[model samples]
Target: MMAAVATAALLSGCSVGVPDPAAPSNPPISSGPGTPTITPGHDAGAVAARDMPFSAGATLAHGVPVGLSEDLAKAPQWKQVVSNAGGASRYQKSDGCQVAAEVRQNQWPLVAADDRASTAALFAYLDPTVLPAYLKPASLRWGGERGKPGPAVDVLVLERAAKPTGQKAGRATVVLARVFGTAGSSVYVSASCPTAAALAAARADIAQWLTVVPPG
Candidate 1:
């Protein structure tokens, strides 16, 4: 019924669609034939480096959902460059730091299901192996919060990528993404940071900013 999750910015308009997690080019580790009963916690061996916060909030609440609320792009570090309607947007800073939401669906079945497999699928969608060398974490982890999860799935993933062309490529380009679902809606959110400090701050803000509409 519950377990720990192991964990996109999209552009709005200009014909940008919700970046489908299934669209990645690499082959993924299949969820397998049957659902594996994975306890809602992380094993030190399978999940090395369990240093992040345990549970994000007091208890699970449904209905309310999360989104890219902060105008991080408004600040000088990240200036807004593109804006469109229908749940897609992008913002970038001078040093190639940026935040974006590639998918924001108010009601999506994939996320609302909240199955461990679904969560795993979403978390593995970006597959960190393909990230540029020297940018990926020396160690990776996927377990956080040990509890039974609801149909509303909430997943998070941390990764790194090369800065946009012509910017600083070797700098720490951290990518943080969240798959949030509650009540009856779901969203895929992501942000890229130029430094570990920036990613840390951004993760806190994003985790705190999520919302879910409680059912009546």
Candidate 2:
């Protein structure tokens, strides 16, 4: 399970910001698997300023990363914590679950000269040489789904080994989906949970939110 989690972290390196030199230093407290550490002083204003090309208004989906429905937003269990100028948004659930969504101008051209270069970079990151021993038993699957322009989604699941204490093993799952539209617009969403039940609920919420196209 840790192997799958590590692989997903590498694939979804989503943090975007310049560290604030003056910000206080604080260590991250692990809430559970897949929770991101919160940095005290990161300047995300410039990134947020980049047009999201989507609406941040309310939606019907509960605990979604996109425009959260009013009822859910107002509910005691979920809260919106981050809204960056880079068109990135995040929501948190009381149970330590999280949902985040973002739309950015595809920087592939600037990152590399062409698709080949981009693919090379991606392959290098996912090189099998670095995968952990536990990954041998993990399952990975990917497919394309229809969206305004279509998005590619990947699902990974790994069953953990029993503890030395002989307790039952747990499971972890990650779902990474992204869409790249014409004119440089790209939308990406990721949801993860430590258990099958939590992952299922998270995936359902994400699916419902993804259906609402953000206004350009």
Candidate 3:
């Protein structure tokens, strides 16, 4: 029992800001079979400013693609976090990032770019209710930043699992956070089963993904 608990604690990683800054990489292994697969895809199309229907402005992160807004529509499994007040846009991760895309919508603004570190921490520390118990998160990876000064961009991912609890309890959920700077848009994706042999697995992908996106 103690070994299991220790293994879970070691699974979580912390890779914010500095991208893949040689952070902790390896995720805890399950008693089950092999590692999960990640499939990549192109952005769907542009996320029209007018269509936002919620906030006013939306900034693009430094990296990432152009048509991500629309691509999210493709990810049907992604579930938006429910909130009463109208402030930020929201999206959820479905099928993990590889094959699955983001889905859902809301009118919330993205957090500031410099706040990337905080964003990662927030996902890492998400309330158990919002996320599944088995979905253990280790670190947060960059998505994109808005504006020149750098507002919170789109997409932030967590590395490994802390323990096991959510739908993916006993498994790792790569927490993904997406923010729309202008239309107050935001989305969170809990990518599951991150498997890297080294202590730096999460950091490598997190940094690479952040570089792929552009500001909204």
Candidate 4:
């Protein structure tokens, strides 16, 4: 159920992972010819990490599961540079933008079972701690789609900094989502963008490119 919502949000190109009937809609931006693509240089360390195979009983990192999806592995324009036996993988582009995702079996009981509940739980966890550490106060907005049996929650965070005199301002955006499954399994996905425009252009495709498979 959570996966379905994430998939829909990605396919629909919605800014938020889930649709909000009351939220104002915006037109999609056009990516004309010569649009700069994110292409980050490869890291040898990351390449060595990808040599590890995904295995069962792996632990989650930053709420993401451990394992590479065929969809993501085969996705064009991205390369998996870091992977470990624990199921964590990092994808990078030439532009320094990157994404990481993973899957793991939950060790705790299902406290937040659906989207609404899971969103609440996630907000509580991220609001006082995670968001503040990364974003300016009141910079995060919450509201997307409701979760199903295993609800999926999505959040987007953006931070801006004034660049040195004469240089363009710097901006960064991070997109995160967690999808729950039966038997206490969950998949976490996240991406880091150097600019808001890059985040907007790539978030949906990157999210959609991931395919989560829970361990048996």
Candidate 5:
């Protein structure tokens, strides 16, 4: 169920992931609890600490499980750097299940001066026409199909760090072209729920996920 949502979000648009502009700059968000300091650097201890243990949701159309977690302490040095640099918060189930995950605070610097305006800019920047056949559909519907989404989730883009310079991989680009970690900083938020009311319930967490430190 959750995997479907995540995959669909990806298929519909670029799912958030490690900054990859050349790749699709989109991956799923994590559902956990924690308020920790997030900066951009490396921390091996944090990687090991982030061994998230939780349950797994159904696989998506592409056959991928959703809801994963890891101990931030055990994360690799570079993983920690990207996570904090992106201002992330991992999540997991209290149970012994191993479907852990993390929803890093949003951090894409190249957001347009106006939040709403930036959303469109990102869509255009990651133009599906420019992507390969496989990515076209998702990039075209990056947020959602014709603006319609499943009852549980809403497809919207939010502004984060100020835009950067150059079309360099992680330096800067148009919109979605430069992902948060890789370069231009700005991203879309995919919030999913099982029901309309439940979707509303998830807003608080979604808001938290959007909070990112202003880019310098």
Candidate 6:
């Protein structure tokens, strides 16, 4: 239906970057229950990917968490969207911070047999030249903890910066995406915030899902 389709188009808040500037007070779109996906695991401290029954916003057994309404204090809970690639969910906290997540299939390899290349790719995010223009004033780094999400190549991009004194309404821009999937697929989860304080506020809830076991 038109109503259903209209709601599906909203963006998930997957990152440490700015997602939107105008909507400083609203969270991303969220809805729908989901099933978890399995990835390569069993010996790498990550359990084998498995499918489990999850409600509209439950923590995934192996994939990124979605549809988490209980975390938010009031109405307008997590909104979810599903498709062939995978699914995504978004939610906004009453305090103006928002979190979002997504899992999608890919044609190219994401978790390669030898993660050397993939590891390099994750490290590339730390390259100063590759970062966004706005991030020039900000400092970015990857999470120190490794051996997560099973045998998949993964990285949790982190950033810190002072509240912008120049940008208007604190344009949302930083999104530190982590892909947790198999060789060719990925799940992008992010906490998009307008300021450093906002991002810190949302970090605890967002990390609960993003830092879970399995690739995506």
lDDT of each: 0.38, 0.36, 0.33, 0.39, 0.27, 0.35
Better of 3 and 5 by lDDT: 3
How accurate locally is residue 56 in candidate 5, as Cα lDDT from 0 to 100? 8
lDDT by residue for model 3 over 1-216, one digit each (tens)?
222321222233222112222324564668987533221332222332212211312333223222223223233443444322222223334333221223223222224433343333344443322333333323222233422222223344434543534554444434455444332234443333333332134333433333223323
What is the alpha-carbon lDDT for the whole of candidate 1?
0.38
lDDT by residue (tens digit), candidate 4, 108-159: 2223334323433443343333332442111111111212122122333323
Candidate order by lDDT, highest to lowest?
A: 4, 1, 2, 6, 3, 5
Candidate 4 has its poorest 10 consecutive residues by lDDT at 137-146
Best by TM-score: 4
Q: Give the TM-score ranking, best first.
A: 4, 6, 1, 2, 3, 5
Task: Estimate candidate 4's RMSD in Å.
Answer: 19.8
| Candidate 5 segments exceeding 4 Å error | 1-7, 10-115, 124-183, 208-210
TM-score of candidate 3 to 2 decimals: 0.31
Give the runs in model 6 whose Cα sits over 4 Å from its true position. Answer: 1-86, 110-154, 158-163, 172-174, 180-183, 209-216
C-alpha lDDT (0 to 100) for residue 93 of candidate 2? 63
User: TM-score of the candidate numbered 4?
Assistant: 0.46
Against the true structure, what is each candidate's TM-score? 0.42, 0.41, 0.31, 0.46, 0.28, 0.44
State the local distance difference test value for candidate 2: 0.36
What is the TM-score (0 to 1) of candidate 1? 0.42
lDDT of 2 by residue, 26-121 (tens): 746677797332323432233222323212111112112222122223444667676643666666666555655544543222122232223222
Cα lDDT tens digits, model 6, 1-216, are 111111122242222221222344565555765433543342322222332211101122333321211222223433333222335556666665555544443312233432223322432432423333222111111222323432222333434343368654532323444333232333344555666776675665454333323333
RMSD of 3: 17.8
